[model samples]
Target chain A: MMEERKTKDFPRSDSASGSSDQVVRTIGLSKSFGEVRAVADLDLSIPRGCVYGLIGPNGSGKTSTIRILNGLIRANAGRAWLLGEEVPVHVNICRIGYMPQEMAIYAELTVLENLELFAGMYSLNKESLAQRADALLDMIDLTERSDSLVSTLSGGMKHRVSLACALVHDPELVFLDEPTVGVDPELRMGFWDHFSDLKRAGKTIVLTTHYMDEAVRCDRVGMMRLGRMIAEDTPRGLMESTGETHLEDVFLHKAREGSA
Target chain B: MNLVRAYAIALKTLRSLKHDRRTAGFLVLMPLFMIAIFGYTFGGDIKDVDVVVVDLDAGSANGSVAALIREDLAGRDVLRIGTSEDRDEGMNAVKDGEAWAAIIFAPEFTVRVEEAIEASRTGSSAAPATVEVHIDASNPNIAQAVVAELQTAVQAVLVGYYGANPAITVSEDRIYGEDAEFIDFFAPGVMGLAAMMITFMLSIISFVRERSTGTLDRLLATPATEGEIVGGYALAFGLVALVQSAVILAAAMLLFQVSIAGNALLVLLTIFLLGIGSQGLGFLLSSIAKNEFQAVQFTPLILFPSILLAGVFWPLEAVPDLLRPVSDFIPLTYAVDACRSVMIRGWDAGEIWPQLVVLAGFAAGTLLLSAYSLKKRG
Candidate 1:
C-alpha cells in the first residue's frame, strides 16, 4: 500500500520499477558532535505504510536520526536511503514531510497560511491546497480559528498546527519528532487517530515519543539507548520475549539486557 | 538557483513584517527619525554669539575708529553687540559666561591708527591699535567662529574707512561644493549609516531568530539552496534600504535644502550595494550568535566602530592619521566616501568606480561566505 502511494502520490525515480522495501533504511549510521556520539553504528529499517515509533530518553539520538534522514544534517559515517533515493537528496524533499520538535511554524502567520506555505513549497496548486488545508484544519480541530495567527494560539494549539502543516502536502513519508509533547490527552488521542488514518491511506510515519502508551500503538517500536537501538520488535513480540506486561517494563528489560 | 522558490521565501519574510505593524514601523521609521533629528539639531552655521564692546577710543575729529568697528559688528548677524562702560566689565561678562567674548578698544585707538598709517607710508615701524579679545574658550569651534567674525568686520573697516593698503590681500576660488552647507556633507553620511543599520541589524537579528525558532531548519528541509536563502533575503533587504535611502535623501534635500552635485540615483545605488553587503555580513555574524539576544549584542560591536571609523559624522580628512587605515578598511567608509563625492563633490560613476568596485566586491564576498556558512550548517 505504501508502494502504491509512493507511485501514485510522489512518483519517485525508482517507483517505475514498483520496488516495495523499507521506506527508510540506514546501514552503520554514526554521527558524532565533538565528544558526544549522537548516533553510533545505528541501523534503522522502516517499511512503507508502517507507523514506527522510536522510544528513547533524552540524548538517545532519536531526533538526530530524523534530522540525518531529513538531510538537515550529515552523519559522520553512514549510508541512508529514502524512497530508494540516497539520503541528502535535496530534490526528494517534496516526497517527505518533517515536523521538528520545536514550534517551527511562523507565529505571525495564520494557521491556514502556515499550511499553505508548506504546501506551496511542494508546488501544490491553489485549489488543492485550499481543500487539503481545510481537511487538515479539521483533523487538527482548528478549522474555525484557521485565520488566527499562530502566536495567538496556546502551546497545545500551536502543536496541532505543526501537525497539520506536516501533512499539508500529503507526502508519502512523514518524520514527526515528539509531535505530542505538550499536547493535552484529548488532542493527543485525536493525533493518534489521525496517524491511523494516514497509515490506512498508505502513508508511512516515523515518529519519536516518550509515551509508553503511544509506543504500544506503533506497528513496530525501536527502543534506543545511548545512541544505539537495543531492541526492535512489535509491542507484543517484546512483551512475550521479556515476559513483561507493560511497554515501559519491556524497555527496562531491554535496557538491562543491553547493559549486561 | 531557482529564483521563484527564493522569491517565495522573500515574500514570506515581507508578509511577516506586514503582519507585525510595530516592528515594521520601527524598521522603516527609525532611520528617518535618526536622520531628521540629527539634521535639524546640528544642521548649519553658528549664529548670534553675545559679545560685549568697551569703547575707550578718543576721536581725533576724522571719525571714531572704535565706532566704525562697532557699527560693522552690529550690522552682521553673527554677533550681538552690547555696550560696557569699562574694559573690566566686558571681560567680566566673558568670564562669567554671560557673553561669548569681549572686545575692548583702548584709549589710544584713533591716534595709534593714524600714527600707524603715517608710519606705514614712510616705511617706518609703529605699533597699531590693539583690540583685546577675552573669550570663553570652553567650546573651541564657537570661539573660532567669534574670532573669524571679528576678523571680517575689522578687515572691512580698515580697508573701507582708512584706505590703507598696507600688505597682501587673499582671494578665493572653489572647484566643488560652491554653496554646500554642513547639511550637504552630513546627509550623505547619514544615508550610508542608515542603510548599514537597517540591513545589517535586521538581517542578523532576523536570522538568529529564525534559527532559534527552527524556521531555518524548516527551510533546509525544502529544496532551496543556501545561496537561494541568502539571495532572497538580500533582495528584500536591498530594496528596503533603497527605499529608506531615497526617503532620507528626499527629505534632506526638500526640508534641509541640501543639494546634490551628482546624480541622486547614484547615491541610492551606493546605499543599496552597501546594504546588501551589510546583510551578508549579518549572515556571517549570525553564525557566532546563539540567539536573538546574542545577535543583538553584536550590533554595538559593529555599529560603534562603523559610526566612529566610517567617517559618518566627520570628514575622513579630520580623522587622525593613525585611524586612516582603520577607516579605509571599513565598508561604510567606501559607501560614505562614494555618496559624499556624488552629492557634495559631484563626482560621476567613472570617477567613483574604485569605491563602487570595492563596495561590489564586499557584497559579493560576504554573500558568498554567508551562502557557504548556510551550506556548511546543513
Candidate 2:
C-alpha cells in the first residue's frame, strides 16, 4: 500500500542502496472491533527518517492503528507496506520494534537481561547484543541499575527500559504507543531527547501520545478522532492554519467542533 | 531460523520463573510432591479389611480347616477377623459396615469335605470343601479380596494336608483383573495424572499471567507467531514432562516395585506427547480464565473427569459398562492404558501403537484448537 502511495520522491538505488524511501505506508486501512470502527479507511505515508506523532484522545483509535501497523491484529479492509514490502501475516516484524502502552519489559528480569532478551529476539549476535545492551544501558543512564530487577525499578525507569528494549536491535523504524504514561517530567524530557537523537541518526519514529506539548517536537502531527484523521500538518503549519496559540487548544477546538 | 529469538523467549520465561517462586516451586516441586504423596500412599497394601467368619463345624478333628484359616490369616493385618455363632450375625456385620465380608461355613463343611474327598477318589462332581463366603458386594476390591483369601486359606489347608495335589482340585481364575495389585495397575494412570497436573495447571496459570500482564500482547506484536509461542512453550514443558516422567518412573520402580515392561524411552515419548496435549488444553482453558485464581478454579473440572473416568486409579473394565465409554473419551485413559501395558506387561511400540496414535491425535487436535484460539478475532 505504501508502494502504491509513493507520489513523492522515491530514494534511488545510487543514493541509498538497500535503504527505504518510505519507512511505513498504509492504504485504506480499516479495523473494526465488533461494530465499532477503530481505524477506518486510513492512508498514511511516513518518510524513512522523520518523527511522526499520532495524537488522539482515549479510544480515538491511536492504539488500534499502532496495533494494526505492528501486525498484532489484521486489518479488516486494508494493506500495509513496510520498507517497500507488503505487510503479510509473516512480514519482517522484527525489523520494526514496537513499545506498547503497557510497559513491555519483563519485570522479573534485570534491565540488562531484558535488553539481552529483546536484542536476541531480533536475532542479534551474542557480542552485538551485549554491546548494544551496554550502550543502551549507558544511553538511558541505567548502567548503574543494570543488574537490578525490573520489578524493583520505578515506573520511569521501567519506561526507559521499555524504550531501550524497543531500540535494542537498532531498528530503522520504531512505533511507540503511549510511551510517556506514568513518567516524570525530567525522564520524559530525557526520553524525548533520545527520540530526537534516534531521528537524527536517520531512524523513522511513529509515536502516539495524548500529551499535546510533547507532540511539538515531532516533525509532523496527525490529530485523529473516532478512527478518522481530522487534521494533519506540521505543528507550526497547524498553528498557522488554525491561528491557535496552543496545540492543546487546537485539539480541544477540533474535538469541540466534532472535526477530529 | 531464529533460534536465538526462541531461546531468548525461553530464557526470559525461565528468568520470570525465578521471580514467581510459587510457580517455580509448582513446576519443580509439585511433581515431586505428587510422586511422594501418591507413591507413598497408594503403594501401601490394602489394610484393615473387616471380615466376619461364621464357623459352624463343632469338632476338633474336623475343625482343622478353621485352625488353618486362623493360622494363615496370622500376619495379614488387613483381615480383621470376627467370629459369630450364627451366620445371621456375620451377614449383619457385613450389612452394618462392621465388616467388609462375611465367611459362612456350613454345619457339615468338614464332614462333607471329607466325604467329598472320599467320593472324589471315585471321580464325583461334588466339592471336597465348599466354603461359602457371602461378601459385601459393594466394593469389588473387598469382594475380590474376600474370595481370594477364602480360596487361599482352602488351598493352603489342602496343600498342608495333601500337598499341591489335593484329593479334589480347585481352579482359580479372576473375573475382572486377571492378576493385578491396585498399585501395579494404577501407576501408569498416576503418570498421566502427574503429567496433566504439571503441564496443564502451570501453563494455564502462566498464560493467564501473560494475558493479564500484557506480555502476550507485546509478544504478539513481535515477529513471533502464536504457533511459535505456543510451540516454544510446548518444548519447555515437554522437557519438564520428560524429567518428571523419569523421576516418577524411577520412584515407582524403587518404592512400588513397579516394573516397566515397555521401553522407558517410548513411555517418555508418550508422556511428552501427552504433555503437549495437556499444554494445548491449558491454553484452550486459559482463554476462558481471566486470572490465575480462576485458572486454578477451572483446573479441578479437568482433574475430576480424568481422575474418575480416565481409568487412572481403576481399570475401565472395573467401571460399570454404561460408564466405560466415558473412560475411552478421556485422553489420560489411553496414556494410562499404554503406560501400564508397557511398564507392567512389557508391551512394545507395536502393541501400544493405538495409544500412541490416539495421543498424537489429541496433541495435534488440541494444538490446532489452541492455535485457533490465539487467532480468535472476537
**Colliding residue pairs in candidate 2:** B260-B343, B261-B343, B261-B346, B262-B342
| Regions of model 2 farther than 4 Å from truth | A1-20, A89-91, B1-180, B375-378
Error of 1 at A232 (Å): 0.5
Docking class of 2: acceptable
Candidate with top TM-score is 1
Model 1 spans with C-alpha error above 4 angstroms: A1-18, B1-166
lDDT of 2 by residue, A1-260 (tens): 23333343434422222245767777677888888999877777788889999998888899998888776777777666776666653455667878888886788899998887767667799899888888898999999999999999988889999999888888888999998877899988998999989999989999999999999999999899899887889999988888898889888777777742
* DockQ of all predictions against the true structure, Cα-based: 0.41, 0.32
Interface RMSD of 2: 1.9
True lDDT of residue B203, candidate 1 = 96
